[model samples]
Target: MMKVEPASPQYFRSSSYSSCHDLFYEPDCPKKAKGPMLCVKQPSCSESNFDCSSIFHLQEAQDPSPSMSFKQAVVLVVAVEKLKKQVQTPIHFISDEDLYDLFLNIFEPEPIECETVELLDQPEKRYIYRNQTIEYSIRDIDKKCFLLQKPLGSPRLTAVHLQGPDAKKEVKINMAFYMCPGNPTQEAVVLGIAGENLYLCCTGESPPVLTLETVDKNVLGSMSSSELQPFIFFKSNSGSTCRFESATFPSWYISTSLAENERVKVSQLGQTAFTEFNTSRS
Candidate 1:
């Protein structure tokens, strides 16, 4: 003895209801408005003719006193018909590769330098790619691995030293740098890490400021290519950690600060903190 109420035109258009079948059931349509209670005979219900308007007609023939007006019934019928059309529409399915490509298109990252590397020791294959300031080491572990370390210094000028347990063994591997095709800018270089792109932009304003910002490709390309310098990392005076200094901006060095929303900045040679970064490996 459950009573089902017909939904309005607005309800039919809403995304709240996914299919027309959900409208006829009292349990699914819990929020009922005050109106002629459309009683649906549960015993006579069948899958073939389960529409709300049809059920209302069957119930109306049985109980004539409490009934909807001709105009109200027409609206309900039209709404039900629209819902039926939406439900019957063919759904186009896409492959997993296609879906992935679609997502990549929507969230394409700004172009940055990338390189691929293969590890020789382990049974599982490893791939190394440079993204911004750090290099990522991806393995067959079903997850992403990050590997960061100081670049090896020149053997001729400075003797290369190793301290860890593996230092005793000489491990040699082939490496290649895949330079992204772009007119290099002297003012700034794009830094990418963890899929985020940042530009080391220099503004020739008062104080000769440098800022890291997320800028568009064209804006980054417009900056002075001649002034841009490769990021150089060197061991600190303590011999324990390293710091980054810009090649072009001789006296300016990259440092991290505690200011809100301003974590990275370029400070004058003698004024910045002992900014240290980890060389992570997967």
Candidate 2:
């Protein structure tokens, strides 16, 4: 037997360095040419009872799963406690597959809730309560009436006489107020020429122009509330009269010219233009 000596005291300057013996190599031990590895002499197979060819196998066999690891033991203990609590009757035993599933479930991410998924996929509920087909006549403060005129084969609004010879005929062709859906306050409305497919549209120019553009009422059935915003007007009632301001163009109201028989248009100034109109259901 060879004895190994401790390293020089110069190697340990502070008390932080503890003394430890190198078991792999000794200064006076004989080393085999096995690259940079330190070699140690082994006893014969007969004396040590170790087959050199199967040493690793024998070592593994000696410690073949003597006990479960910390994590495995913890999972087993938890699984047993959960089983004891859940089972109405005494648990006879638990299968290996059940334990594996429980172990996987402990670490696996939970599935998304059904209610949350349904909310994400469900279509938004629309609240459209003003009744779609209600018609009304828009009469200006000056007693001038709003009547549709198609002189150049294009339908446009014109302020006309209320009690003239053609008064009854013009009043019969009153404007229809299609209240826009999804507006809780009932302020937004779509003005369409009664018995015609023409709707009042605001042009997207520098200064928006009001024009009676032809729209398919059938196609409007398929449109969303946001898509109908161009033709929608915000109706604000004051006393006996109400103002129809353009929804697309804020602060702009539907107005007519000062002179009678002139085309009804849009104006930003309430003082200069005739904006207030008294409505009557037809």
Candidate 3:
């Protein structure tokens, strides 16, 4: 003879609760799914496989899970860890917002692929590279503030998170410096060019503005007039201008750009660099 078991009774029935939660929908049994929905991090690892499995408890996989999978959880943890290490002054980061959305959905028990992988060992440097390179720390707030300096060059975000607290911030990132293309260069030493009129081009900011100072008579007499190229020098390069692609100010900064101070020091035995330039005719 066949027999049917009696149904058990519970105080909270699934049929009574209803709300606007998207998670409340039951994929398997809409009639039986009542009570609070399971969170991605809270899923039982022992009971299920795939997505949330990595972050979920390994021991929990032996039992059924209310929410989350292994793979999904791993992806979330990895992303969160990177953010914490990189915390700094606020800037517009679209990627950070996208990652937040991804975290919420990672636990649907679907397999997830982590964009970052834990390195076996720490790297020697956190390099931000492009046509040129600069070292940066992902964990540093101060460093980020310095990157906003003008003459803007378009930059990119390419950094990889490694494992450990002391672990290096990232592997290699491509750099993008803002470019004004046509701006006066600053802080250049006028190295006078050879010619009848004598054209002077600065080693630093091209077409450097200069202050004219007279070379001492004793020193002037020792060298040929052509080599001395006698002209007065100034401590401050006066008004000046140049194209952005120059010998100095080659990269980008996160902070405000400051005009560096120029100094004038003369030597008895050594020839001083002229900060200012003036023509013999003028």
Candidate 4:
């Protein structure tokens, strides 16, 4: 049975409030030795059916013995219900897109595997040696072009006779060769303007005219499809000279014109075709 002990001079100064310091027992009470207990209460329900559970109390625990009072049972029940509600609360999860974004923020994307090489553009300096016994030293010669621009500031690859002082200046005449990695034959490669993202491509037209396309060299290794074939060339070398044939059009090869200062174009490989170029790496 629980009884309300009126506030006394020992527990509290006022008689209106009741205290559980002398009424209740708590083994882990922090303020047991203190002057007065912090847990004070006002009479709410009748003494016959007291509802002390409605009011907040500190260190209000049952006795160490097996026996429990009505007040102690009510306090334990309320604490258990509050804990259950907290555990039963619904949890929210992130969407697929949001999860992917979070993953990207945490980890960096892997870089594409590709290679870059230099192609010296001196068409007249080419020497065709068809000797079979002299194994070809020029390998993986992807028919790449340098930063060749017209006077009008348009990006175009033109095979012109540049030598001596003009050829020495790398900025004026050069080609970037991109060889496909892991290929046993080393036939696959890309042609681009030296030191630029611009690549030379052909769309397999009746008379294929070279088109300039912008492609990030960093992503070149990941390209594998019909769309990428236009930019890919099959490299074949003889002595110091090499020829780049279009992967899209088997018969077509990248060729220069007989006349000087002519735009680079693709032509069907023939006896008279100017397809072979002298390759040298700087």
Residues 1-282, model 4: lDDT tens digits: 122233332232222223453333343333233334333334553444322334332233344554655665565455445334433647788899999999999999998998897777523211111221111112123332333665675677666544567654333212334434434464566666555677778884687767778787656545554457677677787887878888767878888766666667788767444787765554
Which clashing pairs does model 4 show? 145-175, 146-174, 146-175
Instruction: Quote each prediction's TM-score.
Output: 0.26, 0.50, 0.13, 0.42
22: Cα error in model 4, Å: 99
Candidate order by decreasing lDDT: 2, 4, 1, 3
Whose TM-score is greatest here? 2
Among these predicted structures, which one has the highest lDDT? 2
The total of clashing pairs for model 4 equals: 3
Worst 10 residues of 1 by lDDT: 138-147
Model 3's C-alpha root-mean-square deviation from the true structure amounts to: 32.0
Error of 1 at 93 (Å): 99
Worst 10 residues of 2 by lDDT: 51-60
List candidate 4 segments past 4 Å from native.
Answer: 1-147, 151-153, 169-186
lDDT of 2 by residue, 69-133 (tens): 55543543443343334333565788999899998988886788665333556343242425545
Per-residue lDDT tens digits of candidate 1, residues 161-257? 3347734332221111223233222222233333334444445443444444454544534434342333222223225333444544555655544
- Candidate 2: pairs in clash: none
The candidate, 2 or 4, that scores higher on TM-score is: 2
Which scores better on lDDT, 1 or 3? 1
